[model samples]
Target chain A: MRPTPDPFTEALLARADDALVLGHRLSEWCGHAPTPEEDLALANLALDQIGLARALYAEVGAGSGRTEDELAYFRTDRDFRNCLLVEQPNGDFAHTIVRQFLYTAYADPFWRAAVGSADPALAAIAAKAELESAYHLRHASEWLIRLGDGTAESHARAQAALDALWPCTAELFEPEPKARLPDPVPLRAAWSATVDRVLARATLARPADGWAQTGGRRGRHTEAFGKMLAEMQSLARAHPGAVW
Target chain B: MSDDRRARAWAAAAAVVDPELPALTIADLGMLRDVTLAGDTIEVTITPSYTACPAMVVIGWEIEAALARAGLGPVRISTVLAPPWTSAWLSPEGRAKLAAAGIAPPPTAPADPGLFAVAAPACPRCASLATERISAFGATACKSLHRCLACREPFEAFKAHGDGSISNTASRDVLS
Candidate 1:
């Protein structure tokens, strides 16, 4: 029987799993992004996320003697602890931007605090990752304003994307009040203001918080995640060690 | 030992400043990478900062030409992927060279435990204040993002790659 994860291990593993899966999601755009700079940028961000994933996986798996590959590639979908927001479908450019905005906004503050954490390893990883994520936030923010405030088509499409993605942003801020990880209050509170700036710049309407959904933390996800996992893990499952 | 010959050869080779940052010589940025004397042929390994930087092919040709002018015929420039070139390879004198050219010198990043692995920075121009260090990675791979409080501009500092540890360098490549 498998043992339950320690709180610290769970937190680290959650971050690693989030990064690994999202990195794979971003990797899908390697050759498919609409522009060359965006293509390179996606790939670069994917690389950075994977790197961060490896560091966290290394730390979390330390108690269990698992390598980063073992945690990243060998795990089944049920074993993954990432928020559903990250695992959602990358429907369009706007979909991609909204996903990035939600995740990076929360991640920025998390990494900032993690850098000064009681755990030195997490702190070290957070230090470098913080710089990298800062750039990612800037990139995402620039696009937000551009799309939201651009031409009619851009403004309409960006507003529509924000409407679809607004629900997912809540998942990032969800945590049990007594949870041992960093405080959720500030992180939760920070998202609205952060998103507000981007939306305001983009001329998009703010996503109303009338009925925010929350199940990703409880191991429940939208339909999108299962499909994403199937595609991402197919090659790995088909050939266990098939590497070029 | 062809110390004198190597000096002149290196100096001649150094005349090729990095096309991106024109003020400093290729040697000053440590872009020359290595100067090996194999019988009569000199092999210099040059790695471009960005993967697709256009300057690489032209710089490779320039390296060969400079060597020919220095009387070292049959110079071959290989763009190496392994043992990748980092901006940290910029030398102290190189940063000073940049500042003396009127561009603000790169910041000397502190080797804080939370930031970089090392903490020694001498101005590429003035050779003063190892105390100032701005950021770890600079505008590109081969430079560090630094700001000399003394100079007061966000300058791109050349990373002086010394202590010749291939292992640490490899780790950095993997991190990137």
Candidate 2:
């Protein structure tokens, strides 16, 4: 029988879910991005996130007598623990950029802190992931600035995306109470600082902290998440135990 | 197996070229991690520079065949990700080879994360610092695309590996 995952394992699974879901969303833009360079950039970002996710999932399944594929594809929606911010729809290019920027801005420092995690394996993974997050943050930040300061249309779209996504931001800062890890509260300050810096440079204003939605960390996700899972898991579900 | 036989087997394994960059051998690329020989069993460990590097399979096949050709059979290839591979592992000789082949090596990890610190590598062709990054990612996961402003020549750079510049073999050796 598969052993029940501990809290730390759950935390890893949550982190992995965040990366995997967002990676899938970002990869959908491949061959469909605004430019060939942007296509590569987005795909590169997706690869980094997916790589991180794969590592984390591998760790999670190591002693559980389970495979990473089983966890990623066989699990139901209720078992997922990604933040709602990531699972949000990639509405438009502006929307995708905004979503990516917000997540990377939070993730960069979070991974940096995780490098010191008491769990050495997690620490090693974070050490590798943090650099990728840094690059992702930079790419997203550059696009935010260009779009926000470009034209009236671009500016409006950037702001609109920001407003739409802001409600999901607070959930990222919420602490995982049961996880044996550093307090996330301190990381919140750094996240805001980075976000403000990018927004200021982009000439965009921070959306007023309003009714902050939550629940992705505990498995409750938005409606769009189900469709995403259906599509992402379809092939794996169709071919059980099949090797690529 | 004798110690001399094991040493020869390792040397033969190291001679395998990276499938992506033909100029540099696996040892020069720092992909060859460890080789253990017990009797006729040879266990070889490698670390991939990129998580999804397609060249890993090809490199594995090459290593196995090379070891076999060296009269070292029953070879096994495994990968380790804990101490992830980094581009800084590219030996000084490897860097020169890359430059001679018109591929730029990535800059060191920047101290501060304020700006995109992928400073333009001096163009291998014209030896110019005046270069622009045409794309943040290149054909492979471990490279980025750059174009030399001076020579109007485009090239790929072996990107710095892992987070914050930690590599499998780079922490110990400094490339001049």
Maximum-TM-score candidate = 2
DockQ of 1: 0.05
lDDT of 2 at B162: 50
lDDT of 2: 0.82
Instruction: Give the Å shift of residue A138 in candidate 2.
Output: 0.9
Task: Specify the highest-DockQ model's number.
Answer: 2
Per-model DockQ against the true two-chain complex: 0.05, 0.35
Candidate 2 residue lDDT tens string, B58-170: 99999989988887779988877657677767778888888888888766553333454455778888889999889878877877899999999998887765533443322
TM-score of each: 0.62, 0.90
lDDT of each: 0.66, 0.82
Runs of candidate 1 with Cα error greater than 4 angstroms are A176-180, A241-244, B1-176
Docking class of 2: acceptable
Instruction: List model 1 lDDT by residue over A1-244, tens digit each.
Output: 5567776787778788888878888888988998765776777777768767866787887867776666777776678878877887778888888788778878876766565567667765665555456556766777777777788988888788878877777777766433335677876766566777667767889878767766766667777777777787777778887764
